[model samples]
Target: MAASDVTVGVIFLAQIFVGSLGNSSLLLHFLVLDFTGGRVRHTDLILKHLTVANLLTLLCRGVPQTVAALGMKVFLSDLECKLLFYVHRVGRSVSIGSTCLLSSFQAITISPGDSRWAALKEKALRYMCSSTRLNWILYGLLNVMFPVVMTGNWSHRNITCLKDFGYCSAARHDTTTDSLFAALLSFPDAVCVGLMLWSSSSMVYILHRHKQRMQHVHKVRSPKSSPEPPKPSSSW
Candidate 1:
């Protein structure tokens, strides 16, 4: 194998190792907390989902890429390819959605009582579980086309409309169909990312305002310095 191939394999291995380790640690921590009867917060639940998603994504994408980079010609069967791609897509979507949910929840949590999001603060915790479940279901249903479209690399013979995916290939649709599919797959992700950006910005603004208010309160409550009386005697 070329040096470049070796380097790519090494990089993939490192990413898989680090990502798996970190996500596993987080998963274990949450599991321990649950088993020990520790108080589980809404964020903790979201974090657990995020970690699991991360682990799934890492294993599915990273392992396959690593194998390919290592010059391994082992091609996945059609079913295997479909399952792997489907799961990977689901995991990726869930991960992004969970992150957005967490951000929005936190933003609501820190909003002022008079803010528009104040009402949501109370409901956020209650809905987190359902929201996560719905997120999974939505993505799972959205990526259902993978199984139908994906095939093993060995099956790519005489196929003019095939999109190669290293270990597997997918049947290519016409331009209009492809565009529609792309839009469907991207719409949810775009919304999640937009929400994340909004939440992050709101949090930063809220924190800044809070800090300014604190400074103002401190200034108001702080004792004024007494006049320096001793210096007058020296002047005399």
Candidate 2:
């Protein structure tokens, strides 16, 4: 294998192993404690659903494809290759869409009242997994045509933004076409990342301000009462 391929292989395998184990534990947690037990309520269900979607993504894309990289040299039947390609591609895309939906929902939740999607605030705050129906629908719709849109045999996408190897690119020739697809692919992801970062940072700032206020209050309450000047010697 070429050094680059080897590097890809190693990195992919590590992600596979780690993502699989971590997601499995999360799945176990959801089933054993979150869902089955009465421990889950309200927003907890949303967390459970998100974890399950992520777990599905990891298993579908990470583990099998990682293993395939190790033994990819062996020639396979046409049907086998297509099936492998199809599963890996569809699964990864679904994973991406699902994760994006999860993050977007979170962002909507934390956004202030003046935000554009402020109407979604109430829905976002509630248990999205159980109380809200839209996220699941969005996840399904985002991925429904993936298998159709992608051609399994190409190995490379006809469209542009073809960075990852396993999945075919969307562009075949024109750089403009590729750039458009790249923008499409990146916009939602970038928004999700940005929203999460902003929301988390805002919370940190709020906490810092709160701590400063408490310190001020503490100082006010326990003013270092100055000792009285020493009395003149009474012996006089």
In model 1, the runs with Cα more than 4 Å from the true position are 230-236
State the C-alpha lDDT per candidate: 0.90, 0.57
Q: Please, what is the TM-score per model?
A: 0.95, 0.63
Compare the candidates by lDDT and give the number of the best one: 1
Alpha carbon lDDT at 26, candidate 2:
70
Clashes of each: 0, 7
lDDT tens string, model 1, 108-188? 999999988888877887888899899899999998998888888877656779987677788998999999999999999
lDDT of 2 by residue, 1-236 (tens): 56776777788888867877887787677678744564664444555555666665666566545555655643334344445445544445445544555555655665556767688877666545443356455445544434444443344334444333343322243779657756765665566567667666665665687689799999999969898999788784
Candidate 1 displacement at residue 89 in angstroms: 0.5
TM-score of 1: 0.95
